[model samples]
Target chain A: MRARDVVITGLGTAVAGAGGPETLLRGPVAGGDDPVTRLRGPGLRYKDRATRLALCAARDALADAGLPEALDAPEGTEGGGGPLVDGLRFGVVVSTNWGNVDTVCETSATIHRAGYTATSPMLLPNTASNVTASWVAITHGLRGANVTLCNGPTSGLDAVHWARTLIAAGRLDHALVIGVEPVNEPVRRLVGTGGPGLFDGAVSLVAEAAPAAAARGARPLARVGPYARRADPDAAVAAVRADEPAAPARWYVPEGRPAGGDTGPAGLPAHDLSLRWGRSSGALGVLQCVAGTAELARTGQAAALASAGGEGDDGAAALLLLAATAAGAGA
Target chain B: MNVLVTGMGAVSSVGGDARATFAALAQGRSGLAELRGFDRSRFRARHAYEIDDRPAPGTDVPLRATGWLLRAVAEALADAGLAGDLTGVPVLVGTTLRELRSVELNWCEGAPFDAARLHFGTALRERFGADRTYTVANACSASLYALGLGTDLLETGEADTVVVAGVDTITESTYGLLDRVYREAPESVRPFDRGRRGMLQGDGAAAVVLRRGPGAPAGARAYATVRGVGLNCDAYHPSAPDSGSIGRVMREAHRRAGIKPADVDLVLLHGTGTPLNDEAEARALGEVFAGVPRPPRMTAVKSMIGHTAGASGLHSLITAVQALHSGRVPPTLGLDEPIDEVAGFRLAREPVTERGMSLAQVDSFGFGGLNAVAVVEKVS
Candidate 1:
C-alpha cells in the first residue's frame, strides 16, 4: 500500500531532568527529579506515579501543539475555554512495557498485608496500562479512541506508526502518540540493575493530517515519510528506502544496533539515541523520532529514523522518513 | 477492508478448544465453581470461573497463563492449517494480567527475580518463534483492540497473515480488586439480569488467525469476515462507564462497516454483571438502536465464563462467530430476568436457532472507559 502524507506538528517529552520537547533535544539535565509538582492538577493526585509522568508529558505536548488549554478542563466542566479540536477526531496512543508496575505490586502487597478490603478502589485504575493513555484523554477531553500498546522497546514507534495509520485511514484528524517508562523499585529488581542507563518519564508527539493541520495554520515540524516494520531490519529498511529513494541527510538509529550493513547509497551519518539519552525499556523509539523531527525542523535536513528489531521485540524494525518540507506534491 | 478469520482457538474453564467451548455454551454449561486454584480464605468472593487444571504438557516457565496462551496459539495455528514454522508472522497478544504468576511466584520465593518476567511480549516471542510480537494491555477490551490492530495491519498490507490472541488468568489482584471495587453477588456472575450482582473472575485464553482480503480456499472454511472496528475513549472517569462513548463506538463500528444497526443480526454485550456497567451499556444500546427498524438479538457471554478480563472481548467474538456459523444464539447463562433489555432486542434465554445471520457485533469495554466494538460478517 502507498503511504499517506502525515506531519508531526508538536512534540513533548519528560525524561530524566528534561521537562519539555526543547529540553529533550538538549539531553537530560542533572538531579533527575520527577516533574510531578509542575504537572499537578485536580485528579492527578489519585493517579500512580507512572500515569502522572505520562500526564505531564501529554499536557506539554498539547500545549506545544498550540491546542486550546481548555482541552485540559475537567470532564463536564468548561474551566478553560472551547476545545481546540473535535474531541471525537482527536485520539491518544501510549506505549509502555510494564505499565504502572509499581502500583500493581503495591496493590498486591496491600491485598496480602491488610487484606483485599483495605485496598484502595482508586488504585484499581492505575494497575492497567490503558489508564495511562486514558488519563491524558480524560484530562484533555480527547474523545477519540484511546489506545495503549505494550510492544516492548518498539512500542513507541509502533504507536506512532499506528497513529499515522489512523490519520491516513481518515479515522482520526489528530493523534497523540506517547511512549513512557517510569522508574520503580519493582521493575529494577525484576530486570536487574545496570545497563547503558535507565530513565523515567515519557515522550509525546502530535500527528495531524495534512488538510486538518493546514486548516489550523499549524506549522509542520516535519512531514512523515513511508514507514514499515518487518522481522528483518534489512528488509524493513530496504522497503522504506525503495519508497523514498532520496537519502536522508542524517540517521538516528537505536544504540548498540546498526541498520544492517548498508547505510544506503549516501552513507548518511548515524547517531545513537540510546547512548545520548541513556537506555530504558520503552520510549526509545519515540525519543529518536522526536529527536529526528527536531533536527529536521532546525536544520531543514531530511532525517531517517530506524530501530532494529530484536528477537522478542514487540516492534520489529521501523524506518520513518522525515523532511523539513513536504516530500510529495504531485498534481 | 475485509479481514477473514481463518482459524480460532480457546482455553477456558468451560472447554479446551473453541468447538468445545461453543458446544458447552450452546448447552448452557456454567463454568462457575469454587475458587480452588488459589486460597480464597480471606476473600468474600470464594467462587470463580477458574481453570483448575494445567495446560496439557505444561512447561517450567513459572507462569500458567503463558502456558495457556501457548496451547491456545498452537491450536489456532493447527486450526488455520499453518502449524509449523511461524518465522516472520506478526503475533498480537491482548491481556490484562500478563505473566502474573511469574511475578507472584518470584515475589513469594524472595529477592533476585528475573526481570524478563516483566516483559510479556518478549517472553511470548522467546517461547513462540514469531518474528514480531505485540502485547496489548488495555484492560478488559485489550484483546479486541489487538484484533483491531491486526485488522489494521492487514488492511495496510503490512502483513499477509496475523495472529491475534487475548489471554488472562485468574490472579489474586484481579479478584481482590473486583471484590473491593464492585461487590455484588460474591459467588456468581449474572450478566444483564435484574439480580446481577457482580462479575466473577474467569481464567481463559482465545486466539484467531486473520488473513488479508477475501476468498479463502473452498476447503478451508472461514469463520467470519472482520468488516469494521471502532475504538474510542470515554475520557470521563478512570473506571466508570461512559455511556456516550459506548453508544458512539457501536455506531462507529456500524458506520465503518457501511451498515446500519439493522444489519447486525446479533449483539454480544460486554455485560460485566456490574450494575453501573450494565445500565450504561443498556442505555448505549438503546440510543444506538433508537433509529433502527429492529434491535439485534443480544446476549452476554460473561454470564457463562464470568469476566475473562482481557480475553473477554475475544471470548465474546468467538461466541458471536460460532453463533453466526451455527445459526444459534447461545443462552445467556443466568440471564433469566431481563431488566436491561432494550426495545426490539431479544435477549437469549433459550438457544435460538435462526438461520442467515450475516452480521454480528461484539462489544468490549475495558477499565478506564476504553470502548471497542467490532462488526463481523459471515463470508460464505
Candidate 2:
C-alpha cells in the first residue's frame, strides 16, 4: 500500500449551522455584525466560535468525499476501535490566522473597572494561540503529533507544505487537514486598517496515500504534484541560494468527483474541478488544501495539489491546483 | 525535524524552578494566599496566588507583580545552566497584560499598538545580546505559542538554542479589569466547573530552555520532544473561536506530528470554566475527535493556577509533563459536575499514576481566533 498520497475520509466541525456541508453552505460567508454582539462579544458565551466553524468545514469535506460512514468505526471495530483510517496511515493538520484575543481585551476591561480585589474570578484560558486546536482534541479523541503554525500570509501554504513533508517522508498514510479563521469584532477594526479583509471561513479534507485510496474502492484524487514554498523570503533566499524559478505557475486542481468541472487558467490541461477555492488566507490554508480533496472526491482520479507561498511582502499567493495528464508523467 | 525540549524551567506561584514547582504542586500545596501584592481594602479579594515577599528592585511591597517576570527569566537561565554569550539565541517571551509597572508609571496612554510589545530584553543588554526577540502578545496562548515557536526553531534549525519564557503577574489594570467583569463573591477561579464565577487575575511567570547544537548542559533531562504545533485564526470574530475552523488547527498539528487521534492519552485543556469558553472549547474538541473510540482523558491546567494569560499554555504544558513523568495526573480543583454542553470525556480528578503512550497534547486559544496547540511526548 504505497502511502504517499493519503486521501481525505471523514470530516466534522461546528460553524454557523449544524456540523454538515449542506448546513454550512447556507450563505453568510462572513458572519453578520450586530451592535449587541459588539458590546458583549468579549465576554459572550459563544467563545469558541472559531472551533464551531472549523468542525463544520471538516464535516463537509468528509461528506463531499462520499464517506459518510467513515465517521462510524470500521466493521467489527470496537466503538470506533479502528483509527480514522484503518491500515492506511493517518495524520491531521489545522490552521488559523488569528485566535481568541477578545478575552484579553475583556479581561483588561474588567480589571480596570473593578479594583484588584473584585476582578472576574474564573480561570481565563484565552492566553495561548492554540486554544481552538486543544478544544478540537477535547471534542474528538485523536491524539497524534499535534502542531500549531501562525506564520502570517503563508499560513495556508505552510500547512500544506508541512503535510507534504510528512507524507513524502512516509510518516502517515492519511491526514485530515483543515483550515479555519474566526472573525472577532476587534478583527473587523484591524482589517480595514491593514489586516487582510478576513472572511471567517473554514475548510477541511481527508488526505490519503494515492495507492491506498485507489485500493480501497475509493477513486483517487490527483497525484501529488511538485510542491515547494518560499519561506520568509529573505530567510529562504538567503539560506537556499537562488534555485530554479520556484516551480513556475500556481496550483492546478483536478475535478475528480464534481462532474463537468473545468476552470483551468488561460493555458493549461483540460478537465479540472472547476475549482472555487484558491486564495487561501495564510491561516485558512487548511481550507485550500481541502480544495484538492474536494476535487478528488468528485472527479475521482490522480490529482496534484500544488501549494506555494512567498513570505514577507510578496503578498503570499497559493492555490489548490490540480491536473491529470498521461499517468507516470511526474508522479 | 526533531525538536528537543532541554533545560525546562518555570516560575509559577509556587516554586522558582521546575523540580521545586512540580514537587510543591504534587503535594497539593497552593501558592495562592492573601492579597499582599497590592492594596485591596476597598475590594474583597483577600487571597491571591502570590510569590514570596522578596521586594522588587527599589520598590515597596503590596505592589503589582510585573517585576517577577524579569527575575524569573534570570532564574530560568540559571536553571538551564547556560553561561556564555547568548548573542545567537532566539528569545520569545509571552505576556498578556500591558506593563502594569509602565501603566502605573503613567504610560497607559502610549501608542496602543506598541504598548503590548513592551519587554525587559531591551533594558538588559548583557542578558540577551539583542540577536532577535519577539513578544507573542496573544492572550493565553502567548507562552504556549512561544514554546511552540521554540520547538519550531529547533525543528527548522533556525536557532541552536531558543529561550522561551511566559510572564504575566498581578497588575492593576489586568487584575482590575477581571474584577470588574465578575463582581462575584469569594473571588475564586474555577476551570470547567458549572458554578464557576470567572478567572482570577493572578500574577505568575514560567520559562524553559531549548538546545539543538553544542553547549548542552550535563544531564539536562529532556522532558519531551515538542513534535509539532498548529495555529489558526478565526476571522469569524476576535473574541470567539470562529466556530467554522476551530478544529482545523488541531488537524494541522496532528498532521505535522505524523500521529493519529487515538494515540493521544492526555489532553491538557484550556477549559477556562467560564460558560462560553468551556462550551466553545468543548465543542471544538468534540468535532476533531468526531469519530473516535476512547477519547483522551482531559485536564485543565487553569484549575490549579488561576489563568495566567500569557503563561497559561506553557504552565499547563509543563504541568502535563510533570504528570506524565510521574505517571500521575492532577485534579481540576473545582470541576465537580461536567457542564451539560461538554460530553464524551472524563477528568482524571485524582492523580493517577500509570505509564502508557507517554503522548500528551496541550492547547491554548487567544483572542481573535488565534489558536495554537502543541503535541508533546515523554522521550524514549
Best by lDDT: 1
| Model 1, residue B237: C-alpha shift (Å) | 1.0
Error of 2 at B242 (Å): 4.7
Off by over 4 Å in 2: A1-331, B41-47, B52-67, B70-81, B107-117, B183-186, B212-220, B242-244, B290-292, B341-344
Q: Evaluate residue B215 in candidate 2 and report its C-alpha lDDT on the 0 to 100 scale.
A: 31
Chain B TM-score by candidate, in order shown: 0.94, 0.86
> Which pairs clash in model 1?
A190-B115, A191-B115
In candidate 2, what are the lDDT values of residues A134-193, reduced to their tens digit? Answer: 444433333332334444444555555555545554545555566666666644432322
**Per-residue lDDT for A1-331 in model 1, tens only?**
1236678888887776775565555667678776766774576667876787787778777778787644546445654424446778888888877667777677676777777888877777776767788888888878776777776666777778878877776778898888888777876766555655666778888888877776677778887776666665656666677867556776666545634333532376766666556665667778777777777777777666656455544336666657746554220
lDDT of 1 by residue, B229-254 (tens): 99888888888897988999998898
Best by TM-score: 1
Residue B269 miss distance in model 2 (angstroms): 1.6
Cα lDDT of model 2 overall?
A: 0.54
| Model 1 quality (TM-score) | 0.92
Model 2: per-residue Cα lDDT at residue B104? 37
TM-score of 2: 0.54
